[model samples]
Target: MTDQLTQVIAQATLKDGMRNSTDSLDAATHSAKKLARKLFEGLDEDKGGVLTRDEFEPYFKNPADAAEAFKVFDKDGNGDIDRKEMRNAVSRIYRERRALATSLKDMSSAVSKLDGVLLGLALLITIFIWLFIFNPKGTTAQLVPMATIILGFSFVFGNAAKNLFESMLFIFSIHPYDVRDLIFIDDSPMFVLEFGLFSTTFQRCDGQVIVAPNSVLFGKKYILNVRRSGPMWEATKVMVSFDTPLDVLHEFRTRLRQFVTDHPREWKGGLDVNIDFMQNQNLIQLSLIPSLVVAMEHKSNWQDWGARWDRRTLLMKEMKRIMDQLNMTYKLPTQPVSFMSGQNKSPKPANSLLGAR
Candidate 1:
C-alpha cells in the first residue's frame, strides 16, 4: 500500500512539474518577442515619417474617424480622401492588426444598425398597444384593421387584378373578332380558338396553340380577315412579250371572266376577274387576279384549308384550260444575255468578202 501511494505521489509531481515548465516557457517567449520588437524599432531610422501605433490609435475609436483615417491611408497623397477607401483600409487594418480595438469599432457599427431596426419594430408594437389599450372600442380601431386587411390583399393580388381588369376592357371595346375568326397579329396569321378572362388563345396552321395576355392584344393592332368569312381571292403576275397588244390583254380578261363565271365553283359572283397591266418592257407583265369565293361558298369548307387548296388548284387548272381554248400563250419574263468571246469583230462567214480577197 505504501509503495502504491508513493507511485501516485511521483506521478502527480511529474505532471505538476511539466505544467509549470510549459507556462514559464510561454511567458519567456512572449517577453522575448516584445524585446525583439523594441530592439528592432530602436535600430531603425525613420527618414520617411509614418503614422505610428499611437498616431493611428484615435481613428480606431469611432465611425467619425473614418475621415481622419482616410487621410492617413490615401497612398496617392491626394489632399482629399474618399470614404470608400477609408472603409477598405479599415477592413485591411482588422486583417493586419488582429487586435480588438478596430474590431470593436466595426462591431459597434453593426450593433447600431441592428438597434435601429429593433426600435422601428418597437414603435410599431407601441402603436398597436396604445390602440388596443386606449381606443379598443373606437371606430378608428375598426377602420385601421380593415384598412390593413385591404392593403395586404392588394399587395398580394395586384397583378391578378390588373390582368382581369384589362381583359374585361379588351373584351368590350377592343375585341374585333370572335372564335374561329382569322386574325393577323404582327403579320402572322392565326385563327382564334378560345378567349379567357385574362388571355386569348390562338392556333397556328401547324396545329400549335399559343396563349397571350389580353392586355398585350389590346395594346397591339390586329387585322380581321374578311375574305376568310366569305370567298377568298389571290393574285399572280403573268408575263407576255412586248409584241402582245393591249387588245390582247382586254381579250384575255374577257375570256378569263367568262371561264370563271361558267365554272361557278372557282369565282364569286360579286367580284369580277381583273387583268391589270403592270411593268411594260420587252416582257409585258400583267396581274391576273381571280377569286375562289364561289368555291368556298358552294363547298362550305369553312375551316378546311385543304379543301380551299384544292379549290385553288382547280382554279389554276381551269385558267390553263381556258388559255388553251383561246389559243393564248403564257410567257415568263426573261432577260436576254449576250456573251462576247473576244473584242474582235463578228467572225467572217466561211466564204465571205475577206476570204474572196
Candidate 2:
C-alpha cells in the first residue's frame, strides 16, 4: 500500500507539470491571437481596407520579424493572410521587431560609408608623409628641397584651405570677415597705404580715410588718368554759341574731332560733341566734351579740356583762321533770347510746331 501511494504521488506531480505546460501554451496562443486581431482591425479601417507594405511593415522591426509574424498568422497553409484569420493568429508575437531591424541595417550602412571616406583620407596622408621621408638623397640635402617643396605647397594649399573653410562657414551662415581692416592715415603726397586680402585702406587726396574692397576696385568702371601711365579722373564741359555759320560750325567740329583723334595718347578715347538748335530762341548750342589725363605733379598746370578758357582759345583760333580763308561773315550770338513771354504767350498747338521744319 505504501508503494502504491508513492506511485500515485509521483503520477500526481507529473500530471500537474503537464497541466502547467499546457496552460502556458494556451495563454501564449491566446495572446498571439488577440494581437493578430488588433493588427487586422488597424489595417482594415474604413479609410482604406487594403493593407500596403508601409502599413504592414511598421508592426514588426524588420523583414525577418515580419516574416515570422506572418508565418504565425497565415495558419491555413495559404501564403496570403485573410483579415479575420490574421486577427485570430499572430499579432502579439511581432511587436515592433521589423522597424528595429530596418533601423539597424540603415545605421550599419551609414557607418560603413563613413569608414570608407576616413580610410581613403588616411591612405593619402600616409603616402604624402612617406614621400617626404624616404627619398634617396642625403638627409641634409633632401631636407632643404623637401622644406622648399613643402613651403611652396603650404602657401598654395593654405590659401585654398582658407577659402574652402570660409565658404563652408558662409554656407552655415557665419561671418568670417570679422576683423576690421586697418585704415592708413597719412598726409603723404603719394597714396601709399596697406592693403588686405579683400580690402584696401587708404587716405584719399582730400585726406579722407577710405576702405574699398578689391572686388570693387577691380570691377568698377574707372576713368584712368593717363598722366604718365596712370589713370586720371577729371572731365570738362564747354557750351559754345550757335549763331556761328553752319560752315564755320562744321569746320570747328571737324577740327576738334581731328585734334582728339590725332592726340590719341592724350585723351581716353575721342571727344564727344553734341549740337542742338533751340527752337523757341532760334539759337543753336554746341557742347564739346573731352577727357584728358594729367600728371599728378602737374595738377596745378593741368587745364581742363572742357574749360571755357580752353574752348575760347580753340574756337577763336579756328574761327579766325577759317574767316581769314573763306572771307565769310560768321558772327557769334551774344546770348539766347526767348520768343515768348511767360504768361503772355498762348499754348502753341501741337501740329503747328511739328510741321514747321
Q: Report the CA-based lDDT of candidate 1 relative to the real structure.
A: 0.54
Models 1 onward score TM values of 0.46, 0.26
Report model 2's TM-score to 2 decimal places.
0.26
Q: Please give, for residues 158-212, the per-residue lDDT of candidate 2 as tens digits.
A: 8755553443333224321212211122323223233343444554546676666
**lDDT: worst 10-residue window of model 2:** 175-184
Tens-digit lDDT string for candidate 1 (1-357) = 224323323332332345236664454334434443442344223522333334343436664475555454442333332333333333333222322222333335434644675698699779877987888788465877878997998989888777656766786556566555556677676777666556767888778899988878776667655424555556676666667666766777777777667755335533344445545455666667766552222222234455567766776786677666656664665544444436686654544444578
Candidate with maximal lDDT:
1
True-structure RMSD, every candidate: 36.0, 36.1
Task: Report the Cα lDDT for residue 11, model 2.
Answer: 31
Total clashing pairs for each candidate: 1, 17
* Alpha-carbon runs more than 4 Å astray in model 1: 1-139, 142-159, 172-175, 225-233, 270-280, 294-304, 324-357
